[model samples]
Target: MKKNSLILSVLLVGITACSTVTIKPEGQNKLVNKPTYQDSKPFYLWGLSGEHRVDVLKVCNKNEPLQMQSQQTFSDGVLALITLGIYAPHTVKVWCPKEES
Candidate 1:
């Protein structure tokens, strides 16, 4: 029982190692109500082995975000750590500026 519990605890830690991070344009506050800016279609699965895969999201140090809003999770890295890279999937969100009339 103790061995099983230990394994479960470790797995939990590994899975949670990767978490979502959100970034917004400078001086732009994340409002409580969703904005009408351009946003990436809801996406799922982001890893080498996942069904739907895309480049991992990253933030450039000292660089501003290209879009107005961005959010991402390094699911691939966490899955690789937990499953020896056998499984990896990432989830991301992007919001661009709205077009002016």
Candidate 2:
């Protein structure tokens, strides 16, 4: 019983620690229903350290990012919970337009 409560509390904290957002550029007449380019990587050590490979031109095949969407996964949440905020990971997704020639 006590363990369950502790785990639940840990999970909540882990999830709340991460940031998530979905936003589009303003004043752009064109609107995309979904993100054509996306990327995700693991954040470690309470997000103090992680590998981020979301380079717009190289990875997303775009000149600049137009919008971004991000969310934390359940497995990541569980891992963070078990680790008690020592090992929380996060994922990020990006949307961008093609590079101008």
Candidate 3:
């Protein structure tokens, strides 16, 4: 039991220590329907760290909604990646949603 408890504690600590991300609403906020296709949705900026991704739907001004829209949540990250011109803040990021598959 002691060995198991120690391992579990270490695992939890490692999981908690990850990068965090920030998001901003670019241009205008658009409404989107989530996993369900037939309901109201909210304008949102999805914040992801590393290579994480999510699908978002948005309706154009005079057209129906579009799906699988991609937006950049890491402007500073890209700069940091190319060189050391900019520094991306290190933060722990945890997505609250679960994967469907």
- TM-score to native of every candidate shown: 0.38, 0.55, 0.21
Provide C-alpha RMSD values for all models, in order: 8.2, 4.8, 14.0
lDDT by residue for model 1 over 1-101, one digit each (tens)?
99999999898676646655556667767643443333232323334333432232332233333443343345445555566545444444444343445
User: Candidate 3, 97: how far from true, in Å?
Assistant: 36
User: Can you write out model 2's per-residue Cα lDDT over 9-67, one digit (the tens) per residue?
Assistant: 88687566555666567875544466666545666776678666556556556456777
Which lDDT value does model 2 have at 39?
A: 45
Kindly list the per-residue Cα lDDT of model 3 for residues 10-36, writing each as its tens digit: 864543333433342456344343522
Model 3 poorest ten-residue lDDT run: 38-47
The residue ranges of model 1 lying beyond 4 angstroms of the native Cα positions read: 31-83
Task: Compute the lDDT for candidate 2.
Answer: 0.66
Inter-residue clash pairs, candidate 1: 46-90
Candidate 3 Cα lDDT to native: 0.35
- Sorting all predicted structures by lDDT, with the top scorer first, yields 2, 1, 3
Error of 2 at 32 (Å): 9.1
